[model samples]
Target: MSTTTDTAPITIHIPTPLRAYTDEQATATVEAATVGAALRALVDHYPELDANLYTDDGTLRSFVNIYRGDEDIRHLDGPDTALEAGDELSIVPSIAGG
Candidate 1:
């Protein structure tokens, strides 16, 4: 991929529960080459969100699921999933209910 493509802006949808960490913004725009990079940028921009999204081992928390459009990243390339310009990644948290 070209430098321009790697630097393309990717929008990540922040779920309602995590909104408080992002100043209440529903979405965050970042320039990254992969889903992981975009996520890191978001956490870097909002340091407080790290503990909520990642485990102490530096891996994504199991309860958090990220999707690109209708497909989950795990079904794609996981966090290494390549991102293109205008790509939108949504963070979906798992909810357990009886």
Candidate 2:
């Protein structure tokens, strides 16, 4: 017998501070083949988050930290990290104060 499974969209958790840009949503689902595509789709859906998440050169902001599961994206392929169905991505922003 042969079996086939349908892939599900990836889930991204928006940080509390950035939730406002996502319609106050805590989580968003996007259909993408890679982390870069997922992030692009997210910003496309919520244009307000573009400036907060990425720079004018289309690179993620230095203060932003993206993780796939518990592994940091930076340790992976950065933005080009491969993604599978049901993967969860968390967007964390660095907080600074003295």
lDDT of 2: 0.87
Best by TM-score: 1
Quote the lDDT for 82 in model 2: 80
RMSD of each: 1.9, 3.9
lDDT of 2 by residue, 1-98 (tens): 22233334999999988898988999999987778888999999999999999899988888899999998999999887888889999998788989
Angstrom error at residue 64, model 1: 0.7
lDDT of 1 at 27: 96
Checking candidate 2 for backbone clashes, the offending pairs are none
How displaced is residue 98 in candidate 2, in Å? 4.2
Q: Residue by residue across 1-98, what tens digits does model 1's lDDT show?
A: 27625566999999898899999999999999989899999999999999999999999998899999889999999988988889999999988878
State the displacement of the C-alpha of residue 68, model 1, in Å, after optimal TM-score superposition: 0.7
Residue 89 miss distance in model 1 (angstroms) = 0.5
Q: Highest lDDT: which candidate?
A: 1
